[model samples]
Target: MSAPERIPPRSVTSAELLAEGELTVRGRIRDASNAALFCTVAHAGQEASCVYKPVAGERPLWDFPDGTLAGREVAAYEVSEATGWGLVPPTVLRDGPYGEGMCQLWIEATQDAELLALVDEEEPGPGWKAIGFAEVGQGRTALLVHADDERLRRMAVLDAVINNADRKGGHLLPAPDGRLYGIDHGVTFNAENKLRTLLWGWAGEPLPPEAVGVLKGLRDALGEGGSLALRLAALITPAEVAATRARVEALLASGRHPEPNGEWPAIPWPPV
Candidate 1:
């Protein structure tokens, strides 16, 4: 028999990550019900670790239709990248172990000790912001905290725009290079106003000029036949895309941080 060709793994550019390739499942994240897997992808000699969530494995949600979560994750990444905040890791939709799904660059979080120290604190230290105090367990009080860093704040703005239904504290990742990454965005961009998050600290505050500029930029990119709007239409419903545009317009029109609607709880269950 003839010998099979073996391609060496190498580095890949951001644009090339989405190219067609075979994804090898290295491990499974058993904790999540959706059968999320850790995969290694080699394209053009470039090797990278990516998280893959196949549509076949996705658990059906009452509010969100089944098999659509994967696309929403990619759409969130699209919005994040378009905002120029870089809040979301590079992601792409591709065939995976189970079926068509989302593949996102894996972000290695900082040490647990550091995260524990911050979580133990009664108030957020410098460069951090306290979301609020809550009875964590059996009357044991704990404070919910988020990075006060501008990048994270930008993510908060994104959550508002996308109407993210899940922004748990643990969803925030502290990268080794010091940049923060927000993940687990499958429950986003609904036509309804469903912004549940832990970033209400900035509620009612005037939007900084820079943040407003980012919003303006996104709004322009989401206009008729705009790249972002067009991309989102493929992932989600057009009405959801219109809702995103409306939210951006609302943010610009208000010129201030958003306040909770008082209907749904502002925070997610298990804040951290």
Candidate 2:
């Protein structure tokens, strides 16, 4: 038997990264309930690696319709881009090995060692904020820490506006270039206020000037006859889009971080 050909990595424009491409499934991501594959995609003779999650691989959720998680993921990227925060990597919905799904640029972690250390400390290091405590294991309580970086702060604001339902620790990625990105937004944009996350350290604090600016841009972009609403409508229900607009309005009206008030837990399971 002959060995399969290796797909050489090639640089491509961001547009190409999210456009139609030749997808080759590589492997699976562990611990994910839905099917996620590591894949290399080729477009215009340029190759890029990304994470692919097909709709057909989605597990049914009581709150969301079947085969909708992948769309939700793309919807999240749309929101992120509309805000001009660029917190989410380029993501697109397209057909893949298992059927139609979302494909997002893969982000490699940069500050893993530093972040790992911070998580282990109850009083996390300076420039870090310990929001809450989680019982990790062995009767030890690990502090849920978030970086004091501006990008991360903007991400928190973005989550509030989008009503991100799950912002696990692992979803916050610091790239080698010092850029931070957020991923795994399959559970976002719900009609209900389902913003569960470990980013409560900024709760009650006034929204920073940059954060407020981003929200304003997002608000304008989501207005009637705006592009954001149109883009989101294709991926999620109108109710979800309305809820997103409402959340943005609420955030702008409050002018500060929100306090957890929902019946659901403020943090995600397996917090890390």
lDDT per model vs. reference:
0.83, 0.83
Residues 75-159, candidate 1: write the lDDT tens digits.
9999998988888988888876687888888889886523322367666777667777777678777676665667667878999
Which residues of candidate 1, in runs, are more than 4 Å off? Answer: 1-11, 112-128, 138-140
lDDT tens digits, residues 218-263, model 2?
A: 8888888889999998999888888898888898899999989968
| Residue range with the least summed lDDT across 10 consecutive positions in model 1 | 111-120
Estimated TM-score for each candidate = 0.88, 0.89
Prediction 1 TM-score vs. true: 0.88
